[model samples]
Target: MKTANNRLDIAIKKLYTAFHDDCLHPECCKQCAVGNILDHSDAWKHFSDDHGSTKLNYIGHVNETFGKRFNGYTPSELLLIEVTFLKACGYQLPLHFKNNKPENPTNKDNLFKGLQAVIELLCELDKSPNVMDYTKLFDNLRISKKSLVLK
Candidate 1:
């Protein structure tokens, strides 16, 4: 079996490699949200500009557009909001899965290069996916009143 460290290394390496083409090239990036943020900030800014769209409008629009296709409020829509806003602010998040509907704190591991990344992820959470999946990260993670409130 692989050690935790080995698994982490492979995961990170995979993250970088999976996005290599989209990271450097646009045509391959296609409608990729994080790629757009990384390689095409200006265009992403158009979507996320001006403190950008709020969770209400942004999510509602997605619900109408892609949500209709997926059945409703999926990771795709949430990821779009997450990636677009983060990119507008200049942090390219990982687009790991094709249909990933990111809940909150989806990948705290994505430490982004630094503080800016953290803040962007925080802000995006305020605007999208209302669940805090990283409750598992806290040393105090447990089923309590707070956890229930958060849930």
Candidate 2:
């Protein structure tokens, strides 16, 4: 059994690879956020009918009822993560053609935003610090302490 931390690490790494390879896509189940977390499996698509929808379907409810977890995330949690990714990527929920979407879905900036949001959620789910967060590296307190030591 994989620990939550281990699952989160695997998810982050997979997402990083997807983003780097420009394989992340809102329309492709195997390239979506949850899909990447599940090792590029499109099985997660059965969780919801719509691409970005959070409302679970029959399969999702059954899985959730059985306490099934895919890659350490429950069915509902997977939907939340996917919604977060799509939203951050500038897609309106449910992924309709009429809904708003990024002018260029594959743009690095858009994908980076999506990845960041997904990573944050993954960290939150595991109660771990977000590895993608580098802001702490520039903390003034740490910098001041370093300067004092240097002095």
Candidate 2 lDDT over residue span 27-122, tens digit each? 788898988888889888898888788899999999999999998899999999999999999999889999999898888888889899998888
Q: How well does candidate 2 score on lDDT at residue 23?
A: 81
Off by over 4 Å in 2: 1-4, 140-142, 145-150
TM-score of every candidate: 0.24, 0.89
- Number of the predicted model whose TM-score against the real structure is largest: 2
Quote the lDDT for 93 in model 1: 43
Which whole-number lDDT from 0 to 100 does residue 149 have in model 2? Answer: 100
Candidate 1 collision pairs: 75-101
Cα RMSD (angstroms) for every candidate in the order listed? 13.7, 2.9
For residues 1-151, what per-residue lDDT tens digits would candidate 1 score against the true structure?
Answer: 1223432233224334434532322113322333333333333323332322333346445555654422122434434544443443334344233433334322333323222332334335345321233545575655565778986
Stretches of candidate 1 exceeding 4 Å from the true structure = 1-15, 22-59, 62-66, 69-76, 79-151
Give the 10-residue window scoring lowest on summed lDDT in candidate 1. Answer: 24-33
